[model samples]
Target chain A: MILTEMMMKVTPIKNGTVIDHISAGQALNVLKILGIYHTTDATISVLMNVTSRNLGKKDIVKVEMRELEVGEVNKIALIAPGATINIIRDYEVAEKYAVDMPDLIVGVMRCPNHNCISNTDEPIKSQFLVKNKNPVVLRCLYCEQTITENIADYLI
Target chain B: MFEKRHVLSMREFSREEIDAVLAMADTLEPYAYGGNCNSLTGKILALLFFEPSTRTRMSFETAMMRMGGKTLNLGPAEGSAIAKGESLADTIRVIGCYADALVIRHPKEGSAQLASEFSPVPVLNAGDGAGHHPTQTLLDLYTIRKESHLDELSITLLGDLKYGRTVHSLAYALALYGAEITLVSPPSLRMPDQIKADLEAKGTTVRETGDLNEVIEEIDVLYVTRIQRERFPDPREYQKVARSYKITTDLLKKVKDDLIIMHPLPRVDEIDPEVDGTKHAVYFRQSFYGVPVRMALLKMLIGGDDID
Candidate 1:
C-alpha cells in the first residue's frame, strides 16, 4: 500500500484549528501559548521542522475539536508572527487567515518586570504594547519595561 | 489642556503640550512664592508617598496649599493601611473618594501608574522606583528654561543614568526641545542603551563620555545626580564611582561662562559646598521651581478654566 505524503504526515482533523507556517522550532511554545500540555483531552498533532515552499522550514500544530480564540490567536502572533490559522470543519478548510499581531495585548502574558504594577495585587491585568512584530518585543504598559527575550516563558 | 489628565510619564506629552505646561507655570509663578491664589479652593489632593521624599512631597503640598487646595498625605508606609496588608488598589480606591486628584510616590516602579488605574480623579506621579518622575522632569525643564535657553542648548547629564529616574525622563524631554545631550557616567551606570537609542532614533544628537572635563567647557547645562549607594551591589564600586564624579570649584573653572549646574537636591557629596555660592549653582533655585511647576500641574488638573 502506497502511503501519500499527507498520510505520512498529520492526518486531517474533522474539526478544529491548524496553525500552519509557525516559525520552525516553535510548536511547543505554540502549544504552551494555547495551554495545551500533556493534560489536554483534545487530540493534538505537532509537525515540527516540516518543509514548506513559503518558509524553508516551519512548524504546524493541529488540534482536534478546538478552534482558536482571539486571545489564543494574538498570543500565537507574538511568538510566531508569520503563522497562518486555518479553521477545519468536517475535514474541509472552512476559513483561513494569517495571524495579525495586535497593537496592544492585554491579559495574555505576565510582564517580566517584577516591579510592574501588573505584578502587584492590584485588580489589573498585564498589558503590553507590541513595539516590534518579527522577533517580537513587548513593552509593558505599566512599568514601561520592554520584554524582548524568551517571550514564551512570560505566557500567563 | 491638562484637565483630568494623568501625568504618568514624560513620553505621554508632546513638545507642544510641554510648552503649554511651562507657559502655564510662568503665569502661576507669582502664586508659588508668597502670592495667594484660590483657584483650587475647595479641591482636595491626596499624596500617597510610599517612599520618603523631601522636594517632591513638600513641593506638592506647597503647590496644593498655594492654590488654596487641601492635601491628604499617606505619610509613611509603616503608619498606613498598606502595612496592614491592604493592597495599593484598595488604598487608591478609598482615597480617590476623598480627593479631586491623587499624587503617588512608591518604592515599587509603576506604583503610580497602578494607582492611576484605580483612582477616580486625576493621578500625578511624584516618583516611582526607577521608573518615571514626570513632575520632576517638568520642574527640571522649568529650571532649564529659566536659567538657560532650551533652543540648541548643549547639556551634560552626569552620574547614575541607568538607575536615576530623573535623568531617564529628563533626557527624553531635553531631546524633545532639540537640545544636544552628553551623558557622563561610569561604565557600569551608563544610560540604558534603549533610552540612548530612542533619543538617537528621534534625530537628537547624543554623545557619551566617561570624563566630565571632555564636554564641560562646551555645554550650557550640567545636570548632576548622586551616585546612589543603594543602586550598587558592591560598596567599594559605589565608593569608587562616587569619588570620581564630584563637582568641584576646580571643575567649575573649566565650564562655559554661563554654564548652570543643576541637581535634584537632597544631594550627597556630588557637589562641593564651595561651588554652591558660585553663579553657576542653580540647584536651590531648581528646587524652588518645583513649587510653581507642580502648582501649574495641580491647577491644570483640578482648577478647570479659571487658570486661563
Candidate 2:
C-alpha cells in the first residue's frame, strides 16, 4: 500500500508551468535556484528519478501559479538547456518555453581561468563573444581567453 | 579577424586560434632567428614583472623590438608602487592608458586576472600563480611540432608534476592530439587526480609511477621540472626530495641516445648544468622561441586592427 501510494502519487495544479527533460539529479538544483521549490504563496510539486522514454531517467516539477521572468529564463537557459518549460492553464497544456543561447553572453558562464579577473573574490561578469558558432568558441571580452563550448562546463 | 584579447588560459583557445598562432609563428621564424626586425612598427608593449622571469618577458620584449615595436620594462614591481598602497587594479588601469598591450606577472594566484579586469588595453598573463602560462604551453607545443612535424609522439614528463602548470596544460593539449604521456613524478607530488581522470577520459594512455628509471629507456622527450620550494609547508620536506629527482649525466647512461631534454627553467639542482651542453637540452632554445611564438600571438590579436 505504501509502495502503491509512493508509486501512484500525482498532483494536478489549477494553472501554472511544468519543466521537462532535465537530466536526473539536477532538477532540485534548478528548482531551488528558480525559487519555485517552496514558498508560502505558491504550491509546488516535484518528481525525481522518474522513468523517461527519451533519457531513461528524468525529473519533473510543476509550479501551481507562477511563471518565469526574463532573468530566471536566462539562468535556466545557461544552467539547463536540455530542460523544457510548459504552460499549464486550467489543468490543460497551454504553451512551452526554451532557453535562448545569446550571441554574446555576459555573466552567464564563469571564466575557467582561476587567476582570471572573472574568478576574483570581487565580482566581474564572464563576458564572451561568440566568435565561431560551428564548433562554438567564446572569446573573453576582457582577458582574451578563448572559451570553447567543450569547456563551457568549467565556466558555468 | 582577431583584435585585442588576452590568451590567459589554454582553456580559452580553440583549435582554430591555435592553428592561426602556429601558422604565424612559422611565418615569423626566419626573422626571429636571423635578420632585420620591423613587423610591429609604432606599437608599444608594456611588460610588468612582479616576479622573476628570464624567458617569457625577455622573449616578448625581444619579439617586440625585433618587430620594430617598442616596450617599457618595469622589472620586479615590488619596490615600485606595490610597496606603497596602490592595488594591481590601479597600476594596470594606469598602465593600460600608456600602452597598447600589457604583459603582466604577479606572484599572487589571481593577480593577472584581476589586472586584466580594468586594463583598457588587452592584458596578457605572463605567468600567474601557477595558474596558466598558455603562450609557453603553445610554444612548447610549437617546438614539439617543429621537431616532430606531426603532433603525436612518445613523451615523458619526468619530475615535479604537481606545481608545474606547464606540464598540466601541455598534458591536456597532448591528450587532444593523441600523444602518449608517461607521468614520472614522486608519489608525494604526483599529477593531480582530476587531471589523471581527464586524460583517461580523453582516451590518452598515461602511466603513473615514482620510478623514472624503469620507464627511462623508451621515451623521446624528457620534460623535467624542479620541485617548487614554495609549494612545501616545510623546508626540510623539500630538501629531502629535491636532490633525488635531479637529472644528471650518470643517470643518462640508462637512457636512449637521442632523447630530447627540456626544462622550463630557473632551475636549482633538478637538472645538472652539464646536461646543458648536450644535444638533448632543447629548453634554452625552447625559451628563445617564447618571443617569436608570443610575437606571433600579439601580432595575430592586434594586427587585425589594420584589417577592420
- Report lDDT per candidate: 0.88, 0.75
Q: In TM-score terms, which candidate is top? A: 1
Enumerate the candidates' DockQ scores in order.
Answer: 0.70, 0.16
DockQ of 2: 0.16
lDDT of residue B239 for candidate 1: 83
- Candidate 2 per-residue C-alpha lDDT over B224-249 given as tens digits, one digit per residue, 9 for 90 to 100: 88787877788988887787788888
Q: Best lDDT goes to which candidate?
A: 1
Error of 1 at B116 (Å): 1.8
Q: Using DockQ, give the best candidate's number.
A: 1
Candidate 1 colliding pairs = none
